[model samples]
Target chain A: MDWIAADWGTTHLRLWEIDADGGVSKRLDSDQGMGVLDPSDYEPTLLGLLRNRLPEGRATRILACGMVGARQGWIEAPYSAVPIAPLAATRAVKAPTRDPRLDVHVLPGLSQAEPADVMRGEEMRIAGVFASEPGFDGVICLPGLHTIWVQVSAGEVVSFRTCMTGELLGMLSERSVLRLSVGSTGWDANAFAEGLDRGLSRPEALSSSLFTLRAESLLRDLGPEASRARLTGLLIGTELASVRPYWLGQDVRVVGEPDMAEAYSRALESQGVAPKILDSEEMTLAGFRAAHEALAAHAH
Target chain B: MDWIAADWGTTHLRLWEIDADGGVSKRLDSDQGMGVLDPSDYEPTLLGLLRNRLPEGRATRILACGMVGARQGWIEAPYSAVPIAPLAATRAVKAPTRDPRLDVHVLPGLSQAEPADVMRGEEMRIAGVFASEPGFDGVICLPGLHTIWVQVSAGEVVSFRTCMTGELLGMLSERSVLRLSVGSTGWDANAFAEGLDRGLSRPEALSSSLFTLRAESLLRDLGPEASRARLTGLLIGTELASVRPYWLGQDVRVVGEPDMAEAYSRALESQGVAPKILDSEEMTLAGFRAAHEALAAHAH
Candidate 1:
């Protein structure tokens, strides 16, 4: 194996062994995310995941990203200041390891000083987008627990904003009083569209609008499917309103999980913009491979 | 005791005995709110709380308001349409009972058709405000898990809005990633004031601003108290911005728990409006008493 590309997030640890031909030879997945480990446990955790993969004497290079580089991670890779290209080799930090046959480099996340925003793993994903599509320039959105909107130009992340839409929806539907009314399995495209418009028009009423979902469920018998869609729609709608400056009349691409990226595409299409959906897993691997190539070129 | 005045909500049940002169003779409190009980458990729960207090032979009148009147409560007391007086005694419904010793009346909550809003216990508290201050005409804000803002005139609830500020703060602070950074106790008045202003000025950026709290905590080691206060201030600030029309150039009264009502008072004062704080417990009793008296007068 030429190298290993890993994405260690809050809840999942994903790994891929890259061959000399730049192809993924073997893939592995685990529930051991950085969130569930103590700093001392990271080395053992990685070794357990790569039990038979590492070479006997020679060191195996591992390029990792995500929350594993957080301050509380195995080793903190301080954030790279914004308005810079996504993957700069010098910004990567070497993580100390007891196993002599293991060599790991954790990439630094990006940070914006003015709005005080930060992103760890998504930086690599955005880098992958730029690596493949050098001519692509506009807005890039990665929707998840913290949906991120970025302005990219000339192979650089100009500015970005993070919205707590996904987290808010999750908490509201699972923990809030609305939990009793909203169900897990259902979708109402019509309700979602209406809620989106309402949220965009009256963004200030976002909090009140959330409560209305529960009230409607009780008073009007709004089903779980419609309620779920409406709740998601309202949050995403309000988020789009905030980042309108980034996406309006501009080329927009969504790089996220299939379901979330598709949802963003639909929301964007409703607003007269057809957002292209990029495969997030492919982008992540591309970024990791690009970083490995840059490191090899530098050594030569 | 002449009758009982009770406020049975989702999380709490508060009761007060009304003497002949309309004075509160005794007060009782319990955690047995309508939420934890089924239809079959309501009568037993009430009996358990009023064991020796119930009169031996004749039925003792219990005038109750709040979620107890909700569809999922002891018995459904249908909502009274809005744009009507605070106390519509004719709309009250008597609970079917096996014990003749209990004469229970659950008052209907208020409902707005246009925006599809509803309030149960708050209607009684607003009614109490009208009963005491006949000239009170501007706005009444009751802050809680679900804060409510009402425009009242001529003893009628003209129009109202509900904000989930309290619930949002609770979930974000206790459930989101910020929970790890924020302390359970700490305060930064300046940070709170600044956050409130930021939230009010840019309500559309509410979600982004929330993420900034976590960033600030990580980047600057923002203390827990400050994080808690900032989280709360932001939500309340956005809510105030949404309901600016209700409090602008109008008399405002805040009827809620001391801490929350005081917080609202501070926010209002910052906006150059001095809001009067009324004891929510007292107001609830007064409204319940008023409803009971109206029922008695009709019988006479």
Candidate 2:
């Protein structure tokens, strides 16, 4: 029988149908996000989208990940603890749906110890990354709104830390007072590196440093984009100050979107460390498949 | 001759009319603020309000301070250095309006040497604060959205540092994902202190700590107010880290609104230092008034 796997996040959603051997044959997209969506709407929306993707008379079992397990998602499959492997959450539930042969299961998310953070879809990808290479002991950094630094040892997540770097940058650029002082787009690698340096040097002064963009623009006539760069430098530099303690003198691996992967690696490079990149998409997909296998065993 | 001095901020507008002796013969208030008014409407609205307030057929000189002098306001005046003195931004203009005799002057702001930040109306206030305490030595702390810590020596506004303490708290309390985690009202002193301590201790971890509030509320039931306190603690504590180093082992003076003064003093106390509170309103007004007197020398 064919099966389906989904990765639903805050801003978007993606679904894929996998054959019995785990090869993806069909895929789907929708705006029905779990971010603002009501828990009750999860099944109907997923099934609605799922029905459209399948051929006539096709029987399918489905596994879903991402925010579909968050507080606002379907059934609220709460997050679990460290060494939190794929299928770590308690046995998956065969979500009751209107279509008799359509089996839907939501995967439980993963959490880490020390610094203390959690992840959902990525855990699957980490498992997938590890599936390709067993006994991988190192740090896997997932960069995004919530940048997670997951420590894996002996094939399990040991500990992690979360940084709202992207979210902070977004809020400052789009929603906060800094919004008044920044431009839409520009890149200055030198300015970015300068900011990274400052963040590492005097991190405590971060919040106050944010207002400097406005002051410098008004006082020194620093152009808007330059002021924007200064702001980014200030925040990134400050983050480096705190996180550098854990990451410095260590080998790091990044598993995320390409651009983000580059930025994350560059951030590590500023501290004189090198970081490798892994496939974030595959990380989540492999995690969902791991859960799928676990579910199959329970059914048998 | 009659004159007017106005200190208009984001939420409110305050104007003081002075006689030759600098005595307040009249005062006016309105909801017209740069935060609320359209940039294009400032001239018409300001003139309309002032014209109505003037004695019939009488002319009065007007001076403006605060955000009204920002880019969106009457005119963009640049920032000056600290000890910018009362008369610094003295190229006061006769704002073009239907009434030709009405002269409006916009005060240029001041920037500090340490911590690299700037201020507008508060500059005049810092002057006044220094003038009032002629021979004071130590740090004078101004608490607000951007908290300024000014160091004074020999009756001069030496240098200062700005902390985005208040703004960060407002963001966490109102706009962040933690908003729901923290209830609307109720300020927990314990939580506030915790935040101050944490902020002071590991300020770099702040962006991540903010998200932890949400993670925690989901993990365990953080009572509405406690969660609020945690968010508050996170912000203030972060600021304490920034400001404490300067005040530690040194006497610090607290300025501004009383509650704000109290918060600063408390943050200082956590660092084993006691702070003295001063009248921030009186400081700013006196600063402006001093600036007015210094400017009056050239007016005649």
The candidates' interface RMSDs, in order, read 0.9, 2.0
What does the lDDT read for residue A69 in candidate 2?
A: 76
Q: Which stretches of candidate 1 lie over 4 Å from their true place?
A: none
Give the per-residue Cα lDDT of candidate 2 at B103. 62
Estimate, for each residue in B111-135, the C-alpha lDDT of model 1 and write its tens digit.
8876778888888889789777876
lDDT of 1 by residue, A236-282 (tens): 89888888997899899899998778878889999999899999989
Per-residue C-alpha lDDT of model 2 across residues B237-283, encoded as one tens digit per residue: 77667665568777677778876688777767777888888887677
- Assess each model's interface with DockQ, reporting 2 decimals per model: 0.72, 0.54
lDDT by residue (A73-129, candidate 2, tens digit) is 776676778765556634454455666557677777876544446676666667776
* First chain of candidate 2, TM-score: 0.88
